[model samples]
Target: MNLPEFATTRTLNNCPAPAKLNLFLHVTGRRPDGYHLLQTVFQLVDFSDLLHFEVRADGQVRRTTEIPGVPQESDLIVRAARLLQNAIHDRTGAAAPGADIAIEKNLPMGGGLGGGSSDAATTLMALNHLWQGGLSREELMVLGLQLGADVPFFLFGRNAFAEGIGESLQKLDTPGLWFVIIQPGVTIPTALIFSSSELTRSTKPVKMTDFSIASKKLFGKNDLEPVAARQFPEVADAIKWLGKHGDARMTGSGACVFCGFTQEEQADEVLKLVPNRWKAWKAKAMQEHPLAGLLDR
Candidate 1:
């Protein structure tokens, strides 16, 4: 990977934080610490949230944009920047720089699209480059895991087959299919779905080879979907409506349902027919993160 053209710039604008779809998620088991063991293929999509960062001379990390219901301190992007700033300071024995981050939110919160995680990963990568943090992609990934399990995958920069609470990843080539995503205007809490008594915690684990075969037919299912659908009727309605076109399924936990199409035209056709009540769009699969090249610096 080569360094991006913005390597020398102090301000990185319109930086993309792409969303991810769990093509298939299975709860294979549970860890003793209460974390669920998961098996899933994280497919990157063009749909994304944009972030802008300006280096701050005064050494104070700040978010210029305010997000409804999310406080500045609790925002993952802020946490990621501060974490990297501290790490760089510790490594170099000098004061690390700060940044002013502004987010252009596109992906819905609680929709299981991995928006927050992607934003945080983007912050770590962008600030690492702007501040000359000198952290390798692997080191950044290790730092990201402290924020969220899905955060490391955004930094991993490739579509992958994930296991072990979604941190253990192996590069996987997914089909270059287009997707029709439907957001049912409801937010489903992941914790609520996972904690449900009806949630399934045991699914037979399969190999990457198995996924290779199954990908051709879109043959896996999201185990948390049932729990989420039962708790939120809007999710079930969206799934039922989209299923008419193909094998529609909920990604990650809930609220958003999707169906794949081999052609962009086919995806657009379905996207048009989506109920006016729900938010719908189409995005082509991305083989790697747009900022994957930034790590080369």
Candidate 2:
């Protein structure tokens, strides 16, 4: 994969949009607007989806690839490109160039991995560079948030401790760990989990300092996990199976569960033992996104 040279590159190929694990999610409270206040660490992993981009002189953003069950208009990648195009035009009064975007998706939909959001973030970054939009990372982050709460974290380009419905981000250094993630063969709707009356929304918020101390032992927990596990037996069964090896927990909402290992060998050993019935893989924790350099600092 060639690194994108902002000034000269008309096409950015094999751009990576990595998946994330919510190290721990705590729903601290609910706003009057009905958005849940959340505290969680967004850990980027080596697992990712690849995207290809080619600049178009004609001002029309189009997704050339078809994703089953996802309409092109509704795809975050397309929406993100259009959003940036409109923003650029509105700011400069110049007809912004567009892009033909193709995605090589590896991440599962609704698996609690932030796949779609990450893809949207990658599109924003790639096109901003390709189009010379001159938007700062902070500016791009603002645009990303309009697509989804999780999008800004990817554009933020580092492993982050996130709050305020997962948008307010503070950088945090985490262990160089390996993770074995299991996909439970079902897609979990995040709204379903959040709307459940059984879900608890009153986990006391903890300070960054507390997490710094407790991270060594992987302290804190996902308050949404129990509700998801009870509603989706596949999630419950996966957590139960992986727990025998270590402390296994669901990542975001449901349908995927993970356990951390200090060593790659340990993660590999556990990965080999995962049940064939479940889809599982191992990945190393990433310090920053692969496309972090594309943004102007």
Candidate 3:
């Protein structure tokens, strides 16, 4: 006989860590500590990488993926689990339950999608309930901040109006619009975009009131788009191709370009016309993250 493990004590193991699109990004200032001050509204997409975790009785946190260019010791998920474990031990005086994390790579590296941040959030959320640590969202988010700037947003698991170096988050009333997301098989180093001499360090911040009532209309331009186009011609090409059917913009300092479509068929039609070499995915808008849906009783 075979059976499904419906009575398992685990919470979120296989979770979706979606990519985010910054409707607009502005570098307001630079801190004395060297972290830049930023203001942006991060729109989370349904597209995501899958992270799976299995509880370990042996009490060890580990990663099963070899993320190219990312050191194992510095892996955000591992660091996040360890941090939570330490926090739990310090607070409750119990050895934290452990897990082996498996990351299914979907989002491209250096694509400005916050893939690492999302993974860290999932790890924290899953472990909190799995170990019966009884942590609130506030507590989890605090732990998340030490992992990365963007990790806290995913802890909330919704599209948000973010500011102050992407830590401050306010959930938005965003709509469900399909997207034709394309990656031109190129990796654009985020450091290059931020550090480029031509990068816009000074840009006026736009009021949230300026945004459209629906997600279909373009609220404003992506400040990183022009610089990214100049750095990677492939991104420019993808944008141009996607632009023919709908409004196209680069997500983050991306190698990935996205165009919004009111209808799935419209995006599908555009997909047929796109070159085969580019990595493309058509995803519908999710008001709540997949993990969020799973969490709700």
Instruction: Write model 1 residue lDDT over 103-128, tens digit each, in one string.
Output: 88999999999999999999999999
Residue by residue across 1-297, what tens digits does model 2's lDDT show? 334444447888888899999999999999999999999999999999999999999988899999999999999999999999989988899988988999888999999999999999999999998898999899999999999999999999999999999989999999898999999999999999999999899999899889999877676999999999998999999999999989899999877899999999999999999989999999899999999988854
Best first by lDDT, ranked: 1, 2, 3
Task: Let me know the TM-score candidate 1 reaches against the reference structure.
Answer: 0.97
Q: Which sections of candidate 1 miss by over 4 Å? A: 1-8
The clash number for model 3 is 0
| Model 3: per-residue Cα lDDT at residue 5 | 26
What's the TM for model 2?
Answer: 0.97
Candidate 3 lDDT score at position 57 = 82
Q: Each model's C-alpha lDDT?
A: 0.92, 0.92, 0.78
> What is the per-residue lDDT of model 3 for residues 83-177, given as tens digits with 9 covering 90 to 100?
98998999899898888888888888877788888888877777776787777777888889988888888887788877777888888767677
Looking at candidate 1, what is the lDDT of residue 147? Answer: 98
Measure candidate 2: CA RMSD.
Answer: 1.5
CA lDDT for candidate 3: 0.78
